[model samples]
Target: MVYDLAIIGGGPSGITAGIYAARQKMKTVLIAKSFGGQMAHKTVDIENYPGFDKISGLDLIEKFENQLKGKNVEILSEELHAIVKENDSFKISFEDGKFINATAVIIAAGAKPRKLDVEGESEFLGRGVSYCTTCDGPLYQGKDIVIAGGGNAGFESAIFMQNYANKVYILEYGPEARADEENQKRANENGKIELIVSADIKKIQGSAFMEKVVYADRVTGEEKEIKAQGVFVQIGYSPASHIVEHLADLNQRKEIIVNHDTMETRTPGLYAAGDITDGFLKQVVVAAADGAKASMSAYKYLQSKNG
Candidate 1:
């Protein structure tokens, strides 16, 4: 049977859209390679999201799962490879050679962390190089750590690692820090976290486990190396929009272009939300709200077509 809506993700936004769509009595199915998406990658505490004072990433994902248990939404552990438009509906294709036809599609596949394309970076991924601070910080307790990036994510990683690490070095490629003022202040007050501006990470050097990070001073063009057992690349992220790249209108960053108010994409009956959308705010709460909006807008679109 053709589903009414298909949410192509398992993150907060897709889960929220599934819950909302199921609540509206629509035949909705949520598909993903796995549940929780990037929300399960890190072990950080989420305080900004409402309802909980502070929740671990794993615990929060479990909570999201619990809320979706009896929601009548069909959750599929399928890897969405591509989406093709067919007639007036859409066909969702999976890597496992499965297909599902839906009247409306909600593309909520979230973004992934941007990796530092430097030497020894990919080789020592599990050895010492990491992308999630909260996930790998505990392992490097009492050891010197290096964090790349100057945005809020970088500072947040520094804040979390400062308590356990002997030294925390933040490398920002710009002249000044771009993180929120409050976070920068906290990082500065600790004194354990050192902010290095105008710095560009050149390479990571080590044997089996990471030993030191090599960087270049952008201003003076001087090369320097720091003793760091652990290196966390907290640069930024890129949307997981490759599956629908040719089918939808995407911006320069490859983020799906959608209406901020409705989450409707350029193509009718196709909607997107969360980090995949062209929105500045990348918060869980905002994603959840966007998911709700997308589902509601899809429901209306269905009603109009049926009427």
Candidate 2:
């Protein structure tokens, strides 16, 4: 399909861009395998989003999606395989053998949650393991859940799960959690949240799903097993930039490097936003703002071409 703007992701950035482009009456298409990106997996309350003092990540993104209804933007549920510059326009190929031609492209694929490379992790994904607390937390409601990592995300997930689970255990491999002191204090004060520091997951044990978690102490080397119905992994995240790696300039961390003010990449017609771009705080509001900047820059680029 031929379009004025082709957005490569459906997360906050891509959707926000679609809202802007569609409102401007541009022929925009948003192709993504999934919407909401990393925030979908966070089954916690988001206290940072501007309007709502506290809301679920999924709930906020749902509102974002509702904003796009009836807009001129065409939403495609497909995974992007490759993107190539074709003359003055860009041609994007999807894994499903579909292609789109556009005058400008915005990449906002975002990042993937980091995984624990321990044994049995892959074998038990979805049986008793989960990365998204929002999607899987309700399944284990009123039961015990084990959460790995101690960052703000992890603590937030633990606090969110406390509403449903009998108890939430937070396993941090560091002496101190990476979360802000206030958040850590709140999580620690929650009677339902248990914090384990300087611990490393040794292995995930179960028959079909996760039944137990084996962890070792970093200092003493002592090992212990915690029986739980579910395990949520929130170690960190890696940028999702493989498809556009060869076409754009990427930083050492594999995120696309873009001009801070314009959100334009080294390539003239290409732009990047959100976690896939460097130098911005990774948050829903910032990502939405990035998308707006990228879309405006894309509009200018297209206008200059016609001029």
Candidate 3:
């Protein structure tokens, strides 16, 4: 069946888009391989989002789901393979060879964590190297671990590791940590966490699991290795825009470029939102707002076409 709107992604932005589009009485369908995106995987408590003083990522996602209780949005749990514009409608193909058609499409697929391309990193993915601290922090209880970033994500992971890891070292490639003042201060004050700047990661070495990290001190030209049981790579993220890259314009970072006001991409009938888009802020609230705007913009676009 051809839907009026096909929303790809089940994150905050995609959920919000589905909610708004369904409310407008459009035949909407939200498709995703997984729901909630990175925001749902965050172990830190969310305080910046309006309304609740503090909430967990999973709890926040539950709330977003609650908003979709009565909306006429069909949820599809399928991995997207490709999206092709067929004349006037979009043909969305799934990995299983199933396909669907839609008049307008909203791409809110969000992003995935960036990986450290150092040696032994891939070999010890589950055994030691991890992208999500909350998921793997417990495995290193009473052990030493090195965090591969000094950004807000890196700082937050370091602070969280204080609860389980015996010693946490934050290695940053830059001259200083890039986290905000508050997070930076918290990480510094945490007795268990040590923030190391100008440290370039060179390799991860271990026999069965990760045992230590090798790096070079940029300032002193000294190669150093830190003994650790685990390594948390909290560098950052990369947009999941490969499925639609051919259909939209992307910036240097590979993030989809969209009109700020309408969330519309250069391709007509194709809108983008959330971390997948080149938005200045990568917050949950901003993504939700973008979703709302994209849906409304699509409604207007469809109206113009109908006229």
Task: Rank all candidate structures by their TM-score, best first, as comma-separated numbers.
Answer: 3, 1, 2
Q: What is the C-alpha lDDT of each candidate?
A: 0.90, 0.87, 0.92
TM-score quality measure for candidate 3: 0.98
RMSD each, Å: 1.7, 1.9, 1.0
Number of the top candidate by lDDT?
Answer: 3
Cα-based lDDT at residue 234, candidate 1: 92
Residues 1-307 of candidate 2 have per-residue lDDT tens digits of 5799999888889889899998777889998898888776666677888889999888988898899878988988888888999789999997778788999999999998889999888988998788888888888888888999999889878887888899999999999788888777887675999899999999999896788999999999999989998999988788898888877888888888999789898878899999999965998888999999999899989889989
**lDDT tens per residue, model 1, 1-307:** 8999999999999999998998899999999888887778764678888889999877888898899889999988888887999999999887778788999999999999999899999988988899987677899889999999989889988999987899999999999999989889988886899999999999988997889999999999999999989999998998999988867899999899888999988788999999999998888898899999999999999999989
Better of 1 and 3 by lDDT: 3
Writing each residue's lDDT as its tens digit, candidate 3 over 182-298 gives: 998887785888889999999999998888999999999999999999999988899999999889999999999999999999889999999999999999999999999999999
Clash list (residue pairs), candidate 1 = none
Best by TM-score: 3
Give TM per candidate.
0.94, 0.92, 0.98
Report clashes for each candidate as comma-separated counts.
Answer: 0, 0, 0
User: Which model, 1 or 2, shows the larger TM-score?
Assistant: 1
**Candidate 3 Cα misplacement greater than 4 A, ranges:** none
Pitting candidate 1 against candidate 3, the one with the higher TM-score is: 3
